[model samples]
Target: MTTSRPFADIDTWVFDLDNTLYPHHVNLWQQVDVRIGEFVGAFLKISAEEARVIQKDYYRRYGTTMRGMMTEHGVLADDYLAYVHQIDHSPLQPNPAMGAAIARLPGRKLILTNGSTDHADKVLQRLGISAHFEAVFDIIAAELEPKPAPRTYQKFLDLHQVDPTKAAMFEDLARNLVVPHQLGMTTVLVVPDGSKEVVREDWELEGRGAAHVDHVTDDLTGFLQGLSKAS
Candidate 1:
């Protein structure tokens, strides 16, 4: 909940690659979940269903299922990423409207994602908008530090030479955006249509402090349009 308008002057736009760029209802995560279950089953010598339960537990405890698997089960990161991303991407179609919106945005645009660079490349290629971003900061760039961690955000800004004051973070996850807000960067929550259930507004508000939310919009294009008008 922001009291005042914070979109007065923004020079750089940092975007999250996954659900933020595209709608989650597209069911890409379902594929990833299936892969995770399969990997867990094979690694732990358990049923897929049991593996699913263990995967959830790991995610809850270690922030990521892979992290838990690495620490507890001694799984390799490369193997995990390879198995998880082995899915059909034909369902993803090009979002020309999104591409147009990215083209209209003012200043540098970069992607900051917890996913792998190869996956990011595949998604961008599928969306037909790889040219929209100047650079992409994926999981490799973060050095395995996932979102909601202050250090990850700090490292991202440091690596990209981004000024917190001039940059805005556009993410679908409220927790991830919370850190950038704390660092004096404007935060925009991209809530796609029909995906309101996934956006945890209450959790975001609960943690709101110096790093407060600035805007919440259902459509990224409309939000950027409003910013253009405000500017």
Candidate 2:
């Protein structure tokens, strides 16, 4: 259905964690979001309402609340990562089909996330696809810099030695794919199935743009399956 070849000549595959790897219907991020609000409230001694407002604001402004907190409030990155990612990851089911598809892909596969390595590990393990990844370039690995920040992508490439032209990046947020597309990586926007509200912001919803994204899919497992077959 996509005009561009989805996996054509892609030697390296980069993926965002969180909502991209797993279905957003699981609402795993809601747990983390609630915890982030709690952390913000407790740290700032603010009301729940105020904390919620700041949480979304920071997310929009800084690409992540942790980055905002660190820059503005002098919060420690490790402490924030530890506290915010302390939710139960049991809601995600084992997805061997996805694991198999990823396994069939050529060359290297990596996880690039705003989340911590521990959280990424748990999610990948729960999905039974942890072994498929060459490495996870987490927020900490990027020195607390999150995606949508062009510097983080350059760091990821430098550390992994990945060629942008021959790689593909898969992400849930359309905005996150912009820098990757600009860097010549094939960009795929993974959205939720039959969901009108895929993201909270207009910018996130604009991922289907031809300028940045080459493909869009609702079912990540099925998408990977198609890629495996085509490969």
Candidate 3:
């Protein structure tokens, strides 16, 4: 919000799915995380506990656990994607305020996510905001590459014909904002509201004065509403 004429020049609004779109307290991702480990365990013929360690390690090393599996074990991406996304989406609900605020914003709005379009569609449809977005640029669209990767961001820009300077990206991961900020897009980090207990890594929540983040917000609905008010 401190940036000069915030949203004044932004013609493209980009948002990350998962925690960035829905509240972290919903804990929907927890089910996916568990399923991911289970898939890994089944694939490797290992215990669930051991597979989780590898899953976390791969996530840290490859920007995504699926990528690591592909690189190290020659696993098919579709196999992993299909398995990890089978969790129930019942935890999500429509946020009329958030949808209304987003609908009020001018220009094209898109979801840039590390997830598959199938997963993004489910989340958006569940939230009842599917009509508000122009499109979703997902991991498959990025050729299986995930965020925090510069080339993936470039591919997304090229695909959408988005000018970084005129775009704003909102994400839950601070690291994911690094590439967007470096590309000259205004980067916003969305954090948990603390109404529910959610565990996050120190780096994931650490943003404030970080050079990569231009803004931070806990209440996305309120934050977008405020932006609309000023505009």
Candidate 4:
């Protein structure tokens, strides 16, 4: 494989937990999606179909459904987080290849996720890569502020004492990379393999501000493996 110099000089490696670490084909988010709709339906006393529309609306309007629920319906953030993350983690099997690649990186590794720590822990444990990370900074750690929010990024950097210039953030969402890029961290967008069509949803599409993205990779394992080989 051809090697690249994308990750050079990075001392702190930050990763987003969902589709970034695992392949999108696993479809773990589909379960979470159903649960979110259920939670909303139950909470709002509305039908599931109606709740689904509201769920997507909240996700678009507030950056997260939990934020919108809390703001509009006085729902507890933890309640929503716990309820939605209760799915089985069997889809994510042990990935020693990814573990080995990450282990070779010369830096502190951390997972910064919009999901709760419980969910992050389960995913990491299932992947057999839990020991490699120094910490998992979840939504609660960000005071329920989700990513793409500049303050959350600053909080992650401050709490972890990571130098943005020496840090690199890997995320599946293009919009989330913008603040990291502006903060001097190398930003990598992890898109799904064989994504040829224009992404239809506003939230699903890559940001036009993708100039902030320093690099884009579809295969995170291979990308990280290349970094390992270069080192």
Whole-model Cα lDDT per candidate?
Answer: 0.79, 0.89, 0.90, 0.87
Flag regions of model 3 displaced more than 4 Å. none
Candidates sorted on lDDT, descending: 3, 2, 4, 1
Report the lDDT tens digits of candidate 3 across residue range 128-181.
999999999999999998987999999999999999999999999888988899
Ranking by TM-score: 3, 2, 4, 1
TM-score for all models, in order of appearance: 0.87, 0.95, 0.96, 0.93
Per-residue accuracy of model 2 over 1-231 as CA lDDT, tens digit each: 455545679999999999899987788898999999999999999999999999989999999999899889999998898899999999999999889888998889999999999999999999999999999999988898898899999999999999999999999998898899899899889987866343344555565755778888999889888888887
Among these predictions, the greatest TM-score belongs to: 3
Q: Candidate 2: global Cα-lDDT?
A: 0.89
lDDT of 4 at 110: 95
The residue-by-residue lDDT of candidate 4 on 1-231, one tens digit each, is 122325678999999998889887677887898899999999999998899899999987777899999999999997898899999899899999999999999989999999999999999999999999999999999999888799999999999999999998999888888899889998888877865432235567565345787778888889899988897
Question: If both were scored by TM-score, which would come out higher, candidate 2 or candidate 4?
Answer: 2
TM-score for predicted model 4 compared with the true structure: 0.93
Better of 3 and 4 by lDDT: 3
Please give the lDDT score at residue 21 for candidate 1. 81
RMSD of each: 3.1, 1.8, 1.3, 2.9
RMSD in angstroms between candidate 1 and the native structure over all alpha carbons: 3.1
Error of model 4, residue 68, in angstroms: 0.6
Quickly count the clashes in candidate 2: 0
